[model samples]
Target: MATRRFPTREELRVWRDFIETGELVRSAMAARLQKDGLSPGDYTVLLALSEAPGERLRSSELATAVGWERSRLSHHLGRMEKRGLIRREECLTDNRGAEAVLAPAGRAIFQQVNRPHLRDIREIFVDALTPAQLEAAGEIMAALREHLTRE
Candidate 1:
């Protein structure tokens, strides 16, 4: 008869801790966004476009910038457009492409949310870390992202 092997206690504890803490932080962040009236995804899109020189990016380029798939970004963009937060400008150079241009409403909402979001980020994730720790975290996160996408 083969013996069953179980995860060690530390392994189980680490996994559970990660899951629970991640969910708690996500919920808190979502609650914060319920103000400035943004969902997490909406906020992310606005921030991504805000950093662009023209406050606009091609839909496909934005999708890639955020590591979002085309269908997913399209669905979200549709919702944002309906909310008057963005406009899809038909690309003259590429008939098949369109730009996700941040609209006035989106910029307004982003401004409202930006400060609170920064506070929450510092409170929940950043404040505890030393500068060196933050640097290490950034490196680790980049490596993780690279590893996850390699396959």
Candidate 2:
């Protein structure tokens, strides 16, 4: 069979639905997070640090964990540092490198917001889907991730 050069009407419709639904979900989550004084980026960074050994990670590792470029992460880290959410310290093992550490304030805020975040997720996503649909969604995500890695 020849490869199609363009999506069929049905494929286009599904693509639009997927993109729009993703944006809606992202918007809802961002709104909820903002109400608790954290952006999605902030939450992502905090969560990574909170899970790392010693509640810290090297700056490059942090950028990778958050899937952000070094420059973007550095700027955001600066803002977060000013807000007392995180601190950068010279890496003990590498004089030229630094580590992102979850400050006490960051940890406290993360703890405060985590439960409500979960509740929002449950209400906005989980409750909208059947258990089987949820499982299928997970599988779909895995497939997409695998495909992206091959590219």
Candidate 3:
């Protein structure tokens, strides 16, 4: 039986290379986060909250920022809350909606988790990217994320 023929190269050099690179970065970051008693998602939430306008964010917005569905965000938040890392408050503007707020414990963990995470990122990813490449990478990711979400 004959197999389908393929071209030597298509138009996916960036995509293909990135997938390989992304997994490398993810693995390194995951291991680093694990040493700090956190997962990548947990670090992301803490990072997002720390950068959020008020150290708090509406659940819906958090879900979007985290690239998670509402239910997924809720489940993660529940775990974070149980671990004393975050608190959920009923949104006054929308009785049914809630906000995820970082607590003091969460803030400290952010500092602890962040220092090592940043160092790991610097070593594993940032060092691997040139200034131009770094900017382009962010631009590409933001553009693709928006483009895909819109579709």
Reference-based TM-score of each model: 0.84, 0.93, 0.75
Off by over 4 Å in 3: 1-17, 130-151
Clashes of 1: 0
Name the regions of candidate 1 deviating beyond 4 angstroms: 1-6, 128-151
Clashes of each: 0, 0, 0
Instruction: Encode model 2's per-residue lDDT on 47-112: one tens digit a residue.
Output: 999999999999999999889999999999999999999999999899989999999999999999
C-alpha lDDT score of every prediction, in listed order: 0.92, 0.95, 0.89
Per-residue lDDT of model 3, residues 1-89, tens digit only? 57647534654676688799889879878988888789998998999999999899999999899888988888999999999999999
Which lDDT tens digits does candidate 1 get at residues 58-144? 999999999899999999999999999999999889999999999999999998889989999999889878999999989978987
- The C-alpha RMSD in Å for every predicted model, in order, reads 3.5, 1.3, 4.7
The TM-score between candidate 3 and the true structure equals: 0.75
Residue 55: error of model 1 in Å? Answer: 1.3
Q: Which candidate number would show the highest TM-score if scored against the true structure?
A: 2
Which regions of candidate 2 fall more than 4 Å away from where they truly are?
A: none
- Candidates 1 and 2: which is better by lDDT? 2
